[model samples]
Structures are given as structure tokens and as C-alpha cells.
Target: MKTKELLFGACLCMFTACNMPEKGMDVDVYEALDYCDAQVQRTLTELKAAEGTIDYSMMPRNIMDSLNTWHCRKATKDEWCSGFWPGVLWYDYEYTGKATIKEEAEKFTEPLKFLSQIPAYDHDLGFLIFCSYGNGYRLTHNPEYKQVILDTADSLATLFRPRVGTILSWPRNIEMFGGHNTIMDNMINLEMLFWAAKNGGNPYLADIAVSHADKTMKYQFRPDYTSYHVAVYDTLTGDFIKGVTHQGYADNTMWARGQAWAIYGYTVVYRETLDPRYLDFVQKVTDVYLERLPEDYVPYWDFDDPNIPNVPRDASAASVTASALLELSTYLPGKKGEEYKNAAIKMLASLSSDKYQCGKSKPAFLLHSTGHLPNNSEIDAAIIYADYYYIEALVRLKNLIENKAVI
Candidate 1:
């Protein structure tokens, strides 16, 4: 597929940039990657200078301060975002082939190995290990990274309940949620299971991944295919209880990131399994999400948010779904493939523009991501995963332009 990223995107036609392909994509993929290379190194240097000493526990999470510098919300990562920093480094290394970037990638990645030694501390092990070590191994063929990924996959599998047919998202929340809880976010983590299962980890890891996907597909989405952020199940009966949201606007609302996960997760499942079932299902999910987007193709943090134009926009959602669509496009034929690819190009264009690109204000790639509005935390911030997925999508786009697979 061609990148279709040349010529001009008129400033006057900014809102319609995605549709005006004759104007071309607003940003060039290589140019964006070059921007990422500078920003990643600068962010790391700034992060280290601010830190004074290297603390493996603390990773860059967001830009929430008055100075517009990246900061970690926690002293350590109990949150799911820690892996994204290293993951960004690894993707940068993959794109640039700079030995310095690769060396930096290894430095950031190796510290995450502790994630493998622990019991499943909820279902975030995949985000922690796979994004960091998984990418490290994929690029470097480091046997040690492979062992860690395998060990961490096994660690993550402990959360899978045979009765629930899905991984328990938060064990601590079981009593609060009143059942075996699985979140839509958990779908993205299954890639580690699928990868590990085929690559020297327990073979059942793939079964576990498939089982989780199948079960999530059954219970997590609404009849219209819009998804809830969380799905609670009866622990004893293995029956679905209700669909809800933790980070979304309301219980009945379609959380933007949650639905993005559905789009992305199912695409990955289809890639690994080549199942027409997931292919059809993901297209439905993608269509609904695409249909509801704002003029720029970026989504409000929640599709059902009553505020509409007043709400925070989530660049992270757009970037993640864009990356997924690039891969998903490769799997289809004819007009549908072109449609998805064009939609993704539009998203990258919007994200790459001055409206969202972080520029000089913050060291990260894009801005205006809502982490949890309800919790009043990191609202409209420059989040690490947003940068991770944004760069990942750029890398994928470059790969596609060169007639290569996104993987």
C-alpha cells in the first residue's frame, strides 16, 4: 500500500484533511519518525536530569505540570503505562536502526524483567513485559528477553479463571465489582499470550488467549457492537452479570479507548489466528467507531459523553486504532481494505498536525489525552502510551510504504 503522504494539506481545509487526499496526509511518516527520534532522546535526558538518579521503578507517564515536562504519577508503576516508555524506545530503534537508540532501548527494557518474577499482579503483566521485552526480543533476538517474555506470559496466565473463560482484570476489584471482572483493556494484553504460546511458552497460552477473546467478544460488547469499559461476571456460575465502565463517562456510555481496544485487540487476534470470525467482528467494531468520530477523526474521550465539543479529545485512542487499522487493512481485500487504510491515514494526519503534535510545549509526541476524567487524574495530558502507539503507528505506516508487514 502507498503511504499517500505527499504534496500539501491546506491550512484552510484543516478539518477536512483526512477526506481531502488530493491535499495528501498532513504529515510524512519519515518526518514524524525523525521528530520521534529527537523527542525520545530529549525526553529521556530531561527525565534523567529531573530524576538526578536513575530509578527503575519510576517511568515517564505524562506531562501534567505547569512546566510541561513529563512526570510519573506514582513512585512506582502499579498502573499499566510503564511499559510504554521502553516500548517507544524499542520502536524508535526498529525505525532508525541507530545503535544508540538500540542501546537506550536495552537500558530501559532490561529493568522491566522484574515483572516476570512476580505472581500475576492483576492482568497488566502483558503491558509491562510484552511491550518492552517483547519488542526488545523481536528486534534483537535476545534470548534473555525471550525467557522473560515467556515467564511473564506464564505469570499473566495465572489471572485466567477456567470458570470465567477470561482473565481476571483486577483481583482486588473482584469484591468491589462483585464478580470475576474483565475489562476491555485486557484484550490488548492477550498478544503476549498468543506470542508466547507459539514461541516456546506453554502452548495453552494461545488457547487461553483465544478463550479470553471469544469470551470477551461474547459478553463485553453491546448489541450494536459499541463496548463497555468493564464486563463483570458471576464468579461461581461463570455467567456474565453486567457491562459497566470505570474510566468512561458513565455506565451506559461507549468509552473511546475501550472501543479502540476492541478494534485493536480483535485485529491482532485475527492476525494471529486468521479467523474470519474475528475479521468480521472487528470490521463491525471499527465501522461504529469510525462513524462516530469528530471531524478530525479523533474521538472524544467517550462517544456517549453528553458534553460533546466540551469534552477532552483522546489522541491515544486515535493513534491506537490507527495502528490497528494499518494492520487490519493488510488482511482485507478490495474496497474495505482501502477504506480502513484511508481512515487510518486521516487519523495520523490529524495527530501529526500542529493541533495535537506536542511540538515544543511537551517532550512527548501528542497531547490532549484523557486518562480518567471521573477520577480527575491526567485529564487532557500527554500520556506515554499515546506516544508509544503514535510512534508505533508511524513505524507501521513506514513499513507499509516499503511494502512490508506491520508486524
Candidate 2:
């Protein structure tokens, strides 16, 4: 570590003085796409070099050291973030139609096949399999990948306790959490189950997803729609226990990324079911988050943090919500649709500005992403999930502009 820490203010001052695109300006779809594709290529090439020194079978996680290189992780159950690096390659391949990127995506994705073969180790099977294989199968209908996704969905379904009405997120930490526990992040894993049920997997899979989402909507949120990071239940009786947080500033505060996942996941739930119930509910959740954000629309790590400007911002949360709102916009009509679209564009504008984008110093796309600030881990760094969603949002924005379909 350096003697003088690189705080958010100092970083902002440097990027501001360089004057890379004004923050309030609208994003040009092609221009932003070009920038993101280049960043993805840089990430791929740089990670290829680092693979020999780091673990070859691992995936990029975050950049922490002054060297600005990726801190990668193996594709183990605990390493829930391992799937995103391959997912980024797949997105680049979809944009460029380049065989080189597809080849690398396959190489990275093939190792994660073990996720389907194993028992339910954790709830991240969706993040592990869906983000990589789901995108891969969408771009290229590889039958092998389709089977892997179905199998993984079945594996994920094992953790569901019917009485609790949600999937247990961290089976390994059940005792630590005091019972059957579901986090806000578990809402995201529902997509794989929904997808599998529609495809060749079990029909009950969709039922499980709907149950999980309904339970989360009922118990995971307060009256104001702000959410808890973790909601625990009795392991034996399956009764409602208490709402808590594993990653937020506290049990009562809104963790920015937890709220982001709720927005994104419910948007998916609404899409799959076409349920007006979810559609109406998701906007309430999203509106509360938007109303609380800072001027640029990028959120601080925790909205309730006592230290405001001095605290780190979560570019990843902004990225996730940007992608979600773009899809949410399509379902609505009139002014509401346009408003959602414009909000997402403004977020993209701020992220595209040098205020957040890491031009050359970092191997990843953007900077100032806080991952587990309370643990003092990966604060204000280029976490790989941020890069993944940023690219996904850019592609979605471009698709909406071109009158094409969004993936």
C-alpha cells in the first residue's frame, strides 16, 4: 500500500482535470459501445498474461494493489464471482461477431461445467452458470451449454425449503445465520430456475422461482421498499425469523448493491411471468432507490453512511440498475417508459465520463466501485462484476437505440 492513500476525492480531481466527456452529456450509443468493446479486449489480453502467474483456472475478481492488475479467483463454490469474466467475453463476442473472443469465452466457460455436476453448494449457481452459459446459449445455441444450465437449475432447486418460500442462499452459513437464510442476492438466482422450467428442465422450477420472488417481496423489504441484505427463517419450523445484513453498513440501512439486485431480479421476474403483480411491485422498489440517489445517480456504498462525499461510490450498482431500467422501460407506455429510459441514459453518461471510467491505469472498465466496504475489502477498485454489467448496459442501450432486441 502507498504511504498516502488514494482517496475518492483525489481520484475525482485527477479525472476531472483531464476532462474526458462532461458528466451530464447524453451517451452516443456507438461511441460508448466502441469504448466498452476496447476495454473488454484490454481486459481479455491483460488477463491472459496474468493467468500464467495467477491461477490459470481462475477468473478476475477485483484490482486492489497499486499495480492495477486483476485479482482473480478460482471457480470454487465460495468464489461466487468467477463466472463474470467469461460473461464479459461472451458479450464482446456478441457485439463484434469475432471468433477469437468466442473461442476464449468457451475456454473460460468450459471449466465451470463442474457447477452443474455438483450438489447445491450455494445459491450462486445462478451467478456461476447463468451469466456465462445463459449468454453463451443465447448467442450460440450450444446444446451442451443448454444441458449444463438445466442441470445447474436442478442443483439450485435443492436448497429451497417449501415452508420458508425461498431458497437458502448460503447453505454453508446456515448455523452462522441461525437458520434457513435468504439474501436479497438470492432473488437473482431465480432467473436460471425460470429459464430452465421453460426449457427442458422440470416444470416445477418456475414455481420455485415465483415462490422465492413472492417471499422476498413480502419479507425482505420494509414499508418504504428499502431492503435488508439477509432475511433469516427458522431451520426446523420454517417460520419467519428476522431481517439482517451480511454485507451492508447495518441491518437497518440500504446497501446500494443489494437494492440493485432487487431491481434487476424483479425486472426479470416481471418479464418471465408477465405478472402485473411483479410489474407494479418492481416500480415501487426502483422508485425508492432513484429518489435517494446523489445528483449524478451513482450511489454511495450505503445511502445512510454518515460520511457522504468522502465515502466510496458503487459504480456496479449503477451499472446493474441501468441495465434493469432499460428493460423495465419497454414494458410501460407513455411518459413512464421514456422517463425510465432517460434515467438509465443519465447513469450511463456519468459512468462513461472519466469520473468513473478507468482509461488506462486499470485493466478493467471503471473505477470507484466499493465491494464490502465494512470489511475494508476492494474499496474504490475496479471490481470485475462492475465491468461485466457496464458492458451489458452499453449493449442494452445500443439495442434500444437501434430498435433491435436487448439480451
Candidate 3:
């Protein structure tokens, strides 16, 4: 509840900053309306400048370039993260109708298309193929991209382990399912399954996703609305054993990123199933989330861990929540939806104006992102995924308010 108090105060301050004249109306909504439009323009400008060239998008020009070059050269399949950018670029292409973005994005996507051909796929497949090609097919009605999505879905469907009754979170032979079976991260994976089902007319794939969701809800969620970073369940009987904190302080302690993933994940689930339970879950988690947030609208990496005392906050979590709130807002029916929309808008406004980093040389993207505390990795730094999701959320909010597009 103290966190809620902080969130309300943060919202109140944002409201005042936007100079709203009315009571019971969100000043953040109007301000966000303006901000979303401006952000798209700015992002498009950058994308245009990139011009779909590998050398430009490569290192020496962008940190993403450096990161990708490192991944391409050094990291193995397991360590090669950040494969989500191509999909993000595709997302931008869909939203903006920019041919240049599409071209630049394919430079990233074409290789993944080959990877999808492999019978054995990995977790990043959903992030790469579904987010990019699947989205492209959905928007453009392109048959080739649609086939790519199906191929990827088929591979993912095969990855489902009957032992856990969930898709294998990692390709490792080790049996650890904690955090890998995380309900939060799997929601995005479910989106791919849903698309696969709709496109390929394979109801089984959709059913597999839904079943996994059902299992996750049963085992992972706690009574207090706080989520575990990882929960290992008996695949056979669906029993809970113990939770291992994959990225947070320890088991059962809330990781800010995981929490954000859950917030957005549950919101995505609600959109898919329209289960009242999902909505209730969202409200409960959002309530707990809003209650615990710091005044700046960013969250410390770990909610329960107080050892650091004065650690840098994960602004990436804020960006994720801002995006999730925007999606969750659209599902609202009438006045209540308006309130959620306003809250989301306000959160984004605070993020864009106060937290967002702007400059050419400033590598990664967005700003104030915290990756992990234990290893002292990219602590409180800009992250590309943060920028991608932030842009995704902002664009979604614009589409929602302007066209009233649901889902």
C-alpha cells in the first residue's frame, strides 16, 4: 500500500506537470497523446537515418551494432540475446508504413528465417520470428512471412516438453524449469502461438499455449499478487515444489523486470482469454505494483531486497509497465478504461520527459535501464529492448486513442 501511495503521488505530480484544469480527469492522457505522436516522429527520423544498411546499424555507429557484432562473433546460441530488434523494427514498419524500416529490418530477419528452418529451436525464436515476421504477415497479409511464422510455431510446438507441459524455456539439457517456465515471459510466447493458431488454422497450437498459461497461473501466482522470477512445477501432476529467483535477490523476492513482464503478460493473457480471472489478476498485480513504486516512476531491481538500500532503479521496468498499461487500458470498458488509459499515459509521460535519454552518441536506447545487480552488469544503463518496448507501447497507445483498435 505504501507503494501505491508513492504511485499516486507520482501520478499526481505528473498530472500537475501537464497542467490539467479538470478534476477526475487524467492530465497524463492529453500530455501522452501529444508525447506519443512526437515520439513516433523522432523514432522514425532515427530509423530513416539508419536506412537499412548493415554498416550503419553495425558497430562504430550504434551500440546495438557493437552488441550485435559481439554476439555474432563471440556469444553462442545460448548467450546471444537481443534478437528482438528485428521484430521491433518490423513493428515500426507496420506502424509507420516506412519501406526503409522494412528493408533494414529484413537484414536482421533473413538470417533468423534460416534458423527457423532448424527442427530444434530456442526461446529467442518467439521474440525474433513472431515479433517480426509474424507481425509483418499479420499487417501486410504477406504469405511468405506467414509461412515463416508457421514454421517457427511448428518448431516451438515441438519444443513443448510433456514432462513440464510447458515449452522448454531454455535449450539446456538440465531439467531446471524455474524462471524458464516463468508465467510473465511466456505470455509473449503465447502471442506467437495464438497467431500461429489463427493463421495456420492449427487449433492445437493455440490450445497448447492456453494450456501452458493455465498451468502457469495455477503454479506461479501467489495470493499477494507478487510473482516469483521462476517457479518449478511437477510437469506430471502440476505440483509446486520451490521457486528459484533467476534474476532477483533470491527465491520469492520480486525482480522488477519479471514483475513488469508479468504485468504485461497477464494483460496479454486477458486480451486472449477474456477471462475475468485474468482481469482480476491484472488489477491485483497492478495495484501491488503501483503501491510499491518509487516517486520517480522507476522501480528498484528487486522489490523485497533491501540490502543495497540506495541502488540505481531499473528504468527498463518503467518502460515495460508503461507499455503494458497502454495495452491493458484498451481492454477497459468505459470510464474505468479511461482511468487506466490516463494512468498509463501519465506513466509514459513521466518516463519520456524525465527519464528518456536523447542524443546521437548515447549508445543503447532509452535510458536508466538496469540489467542485473548481482553481476554488476549494465547497471542503470540504456537498453535497446527498453527503447523497443517503449516505442511499441507508445505506438499502441496512439492507435488505441485514435482508432479505438482493440487488441
Query: Tens digit of lDDT per residue, candidate 2, span 162-202?
Result: 98889999988989989899999888899999999999999
TM-score per prediction, in order, is: 0.93, 0.92, 0.79
Estimate, for each residue in 124-169, the C-alpha lDDT of model 3 and write its tens digit: 5676576657666667677888888888788778867766667766
Off by over 4 Å in 3: 1-82, 173-183, 235-238, 307-309, 360-364
The prediction achieving the highest TM-score against the true structure is 1
TM-score for predicted model 3 compared with the true structure: 0.79
- Please, what is the whole-model Cα lDDT of each candidate in the order they appear? 0.87, 0.87, 0.64
- Tell me the TM-score of model 2: 0.92
C-alpha displacement of 293 in model 1, angstroms?
0.6
RMSD vs true structure, all candidates: 5.0, 9.1, 8.2
lDDT of 1 by residue, 224-318 (tens): 99998999999998999999999999988899999999999999999999989999999999999999999999999999888899989999999
Residue 150, candidate 1: alpha-carbon lDDT:
92
The CA root-mean-square deviation of candidate 3, after full C-alpha superposition on the true structure, stands at 8.2
| Deviation in Å, model 3, residue 339 alpha carbon | 3.3
* Pairs clashing within candidate 3: 3-291, 3-292, 4-291, 179-230
Which residue pairs collide in model 1, if any?
none
Which parts of model 2 are misplaced by more than 4 Å?
A: 1-25, 49-56
